[model samples]
Target: MSDDGQDLAEAQRAHWQSAYGDHPGMYGRQPSAPAVHAAAVFRAAGVRDVLELGAGHGRDTLYFAREGFTVQATDFSATGLKQLRAGARQQGVAGRVTTVVHDVRAPLPLPDASVDAVFAHMLLCMALSTEEIHAAVGEVRRVLRSGGIFVYTVRHTGDAHYGAGIPHGDDIFEHGGFAVHFFGRAMVDALADGWRLDEVQPFEEGDLPRRLWRVTQTLPRERA
Candidate 1:
């Protein structure tokens, strides 16, 4: 990792450690709906090896492991990893899951074309800049095997600018003193250059009426 990348990782680790260190159910105990749906898509695509980035608390990691996939999960937070380990033992899938402390701002430790499926939930939005998003997307494309699947979810960029259900301008939104970038269809298409778009849908959270986009893409057999 570069010096800048290392610094960024350390910063991210500190942020998550402070944010979710005390909350056992940080996001939730159960796997996210987007992740569950992505798992089904991977199963349908005949995926066996899975790599998950920003795997907070291992809800999806444990879910995939229990379903008989070799899972490698990475996060920057040691506290989050500890919680994940506990969750893995509780779920009886500790043997199937491997946890690594990693910062996505740096190069991923995995080799090229090493994973059959890659999952990133709320990862891109966590990036504070477009450059970071591009870097994250590049890494996602780099580790996925040809014809592998990439599934992710992000806050609806549109929702933040306009009202929740109304259409508005293209700008970042301020909520709870945090800046979040919602994604648009055009931005999604640009990010998925080498991947075949399988599905893109806007759906609301089960607990809230706010909408977000879920995107699934398959790596191209040949580079575009």
Candidate 2:
């Protein structure tokens, strides 16, 4: 990472820590629509375990646990994970959930082919450069079992805020202390290169009505 990138990452981390500290359960308790959709897909595929990146206070993570999939949720903010664990206990699903403080820029802290499914809601668009995004996806691929499902969402170039914020180059922009890297369609396609791309569906969320793409892909089963 360049000095500027490192600086941005540190600043983002501090910002998230402060944000979660000030507003616990900031994203509300309901599972995101993408999470609900991913749950159904995971069920149909017989997934037993899920790894969620950027789980942010565990709204969707708790929902996945209630649906009976054992979940491992990761986020960069320890404060956010604290809230997630508390929610898990309150929901009586503590046994089904685990929390880790993880930054997606690093290799996932798991053995290869360890998880049956992975979900990341709008995590790929967060202040990450295109190379880092690809590396993060590579880590996802390495940790997923063959035929495992990967469901992720990203704010796209079509979003209203795409170019509205202060530009940090490489498509990253900062607004209200939050930095986002709006993705282009070609970048999404490139990231799915070795995976079996299943779907890329458009969706909107939040009051800003953030435009996003929910991408679902699967690893190919190894040949006998």
What TM-score, over all chains together, does every model reach?
Answer: 0.85, 0.99
Please give the distance, in angstroms, between residue 118's alpha carbon in candidate 1 and its true position after superposition.
Answer: 0.3
Q: Which prediction has the highest TM-score against the true structure? A: 2
Query: lDDT values of the candidates?
Result: 0.77, 0.96
Model 2 whole-model lDDT (C-alpha atoms): 0.96
Q: For residue 17, what is the lDDT in candidate 1?
A: 84
lDDT (tens digit, per residue) of candidate 1 on 111-135: 9989999998877765345566778
After superposition, candidate 1 runs with Cα above 4 Å error? 1-13, 160-174, 177-179, 206-208, 222-224
Give the Å shift of residue 175 in candidate 2.
0.9
Ten-residue stretch with the least lDDT total in model 2: 160-169
Candidate 2 shows a clash count of: 0
Q: Relative to the unseen true structure, what is the C-alpha lDDT of residue 138 in candidate 1, on a scale of 0 to 100? A: 90
How far does residue 147 in candidate 1 sit from its true spot (Å)? 0.6
